[model samples]
Target: MAEFSTNDSTNFSYPRSDYVEIVVVRHGETAWNAISRIQGQLDVELNETGRQQAAAVGDRLSKESKLSVIYSSDLQRASETAQIIASRCGGVEVVKDADLRERHLGDLQGLVYHEMAKTNPNAYKAFVSKNEDMEIPGGGESLVQLFDRSTSALLRIGMKHIGERVVVVTHGGFIRSLYKRACPNGRPAGKVLNTSVSVFHLHVEDKWVLKMWGDVSHLSQTGFLQSGFGGDRTSG
Candidate 1:
């Protein structure tokens, strides 16, 4: 059970190199996001504003550093964001990884946030309770499941691209999970805004150094900076 603990890093391994710098970017806003609806595993596309946000972030990254490759969730929102970023980064290759997907909310998918209590009380309760092992009713996964899947996938990618900087286009839920892993003391970190960029450096023996968290400066000048959609909590 400790293996699933957010505080435990013993379950995962890292590369032998000095470090791998990972620039984690949350996918831009979506239609569902505008309505506070739970997208979960649904393949929602980015809205017009989202596309703009992606381009803005891509431009920022292209100028900041050279990316070795882009790893993205197979979902359209993330993949499309990655594609847009690739084009800006001189056509860097984009690799889709299913493990990078948002946590599957099962029955909660597509339900508006405020209406969750009336629509699916039990599942909604489990979600807000933040119980690590309380899997949502229907087919949703537990916090532990997401933690294991995302961390493992990230480790694998870090190993493959040691010493190189890479961009990960993934969901907010996945980003939050890694935040907990990196900040075991649970210090309050601000919201993970759409297209926000966070930086993590992975070193040997499963060590991770969080260089930055939830940066949306790229969106500020572009007028895309805004609040996050629902599911900003540990669950999605």
Candidate 2:
């Protein structure tokens, strides 16, 4: 977690207490995700189970207070999830932004990891090794590119909702990207379950801070406590 406050000659007053609480929710499962394929920019709709997941998340969020704004990736899956949440919150408007979309997978768009590994050993190896500079052959984004775009989207959201509680519905990869950025030197091992919530506290002083992460208590009530999708569960 980065320090949220820093003093400078400009004399910007940093909020002493937590001002803005950003809740990040990954969109429900998609067909591509179920098959273990690299989705990237490829558009895929949520399965029926995913719709149920989103509804559950909406039900949970509807009970919370101080929900000011709802933002989501323009991708159908994310937008649909945001819409479900908004519908539960008395028809709150959902703001869509393309910047929040998942990292462009380029050439790896629809390929499964196992297939890619067997066909493109070097590329698969580089990805598994977390090589920031290695680009997937034919297409696919490098790790650095994913980080840049993900962080840019987060910063934009942070600025837009400076002192409010904003809900962001995005992809698992997008959330994972932020985690990697926040814990650069640490081993990257965190899963973003469908409808899981990650909270971050942003201060204007210096850098944004991660307050809480991967809270899936809402799903526990439904007897679904596992991270990510359990198996080849498809969405509508």
Candidate 3:
């Protein structure tokens, strides 16, 4: 009768910490991303532009701050981005964490937003609305499930590296979920661009602060970053 705790958002909490700066970077674009197809747990590789984005992000991080560690989703896109960043950082270790992965979207894995809307309007509505309880028809998770998954893993990392900077290479959906959770009173969460950087700080009393969200200045100057890969409602 009970749901998996890590897959439910309302019950998760960050452990107390002195201070920790987390730079959450969504993974680079994939072929699925160009067309706005859902990627769930699929291990897709980064497209050429995505590879460039990853390298840009890595270069930005190496110049912006000193990272103590990098925690990345083991999914290919994210893992490859982390590897590129590690190489750019000149040997920063990237720890693979399945917990850092995107929400497992189940049967909705590869459907485009418009296709889902045309085929299953209600399902498309729920997925787009950020419904906390609307699990995808086949086996996908709710938005809250992703919030719980990401926050739990982030808290564990916070407890271990208080007052340190860490990079999180993960998917867009996961970043969007975490952003909603972190900035409860702020703007409505929207698309998390590929390789966009979001910054969060965990305080000593277990409070979380959103320093920045979807900072894509790096992508803007690069010229390779694609414009409008897909429509507004993203499910990656």
Candidate 4:
């Protein structure tokens, strides 16, 4: 196993505070999310319900502490959500980062949830097995790779904005991968809902603590609180 670290005292120092506050959020719903279709890295726009959810969350976050900035995945779903939130939160600058994109499903991308089992049983089985090293077929990355890449990006962001509160708009799989690494003994209780909020505290020594997980309280009245089908397991 390779060791990972974000502690780079040579380049920067945490002068303001010891940790950074990160509000990690899953992107809003999409047309493919409605039907449990795998989106992976393919660009997919938010559905109507998704936009509403985004707005609701945006309104909720706007009322909280002032945000320094909003970091988002380059994917449309996440970037769109970030834009909505930015508008609501006094137009905080939104920075897009490709490293925050969802885990690549490779050959499994674009397939319906149930059809994957029949279409590619081996790859499907490997995915469901939750093996960290098992890479998806046809150019996809492994769970370990997803965790390393996404978490590294997050750590970099944290290091850059120490003592600041920032938002990260990304995908469900990315959130789940982060939960696994950030909370080694703790297990995620349920699906990572669309536009859900999860909070984390990142320390200067590369430590991470999850403050909240999968909170959809902002969308209580939206009636679209249901998790996208198959969630982090089958879709990105």
Question: Which residue window of length 10 is worst by lDDT in model 4?
Answer: 1-10
Candidate 4 lDDT by residue in tens digits, 117-153? 8998877876776677888887787888888998788
Tell me the tens digit of each residue's lDDT in model 1 across 95-205.
999999999887889898779889999998878775688888889888889888888988899888886788999988888877777776657655678898888777766
Off by over 4 Å in 1: 1-17, 230-236
Give one digit per residue, the lDDT tens place, for model 2 in 134-227.
7665666677777788888887777766766778999877887776655556554366787887776666663566655776677765433244
lDDT, each prediction: 0.80, 0.70, 0.74, 0.81
In order, how many clashes per candidate?
0, 10, 2, 0
Candidate 1 yields a Cα-based lDDT of: 0.80
State the displacement of the C-alpha of residue 5, model 3, in Å, after optimal TM-score superposition: 30
- Order of models, best TM-score first: 1, 4, 3, 2
Candidate 2: lDDT over CA atoms? 0.70
What is candidate 2's CA lDDT for residue 60?
80
Where does candidate 2 stray beyond 4 Å? 1-18, 120-126, 185-187, 221-236
Q: What's the C-alpha lDDT at position 134 in model 1?
A: 81
TM-score of each: 0.89, 0.82, 0.84, 0.89
Q: Candidate 4: deviation at residue 35, Å?
A: 0.6
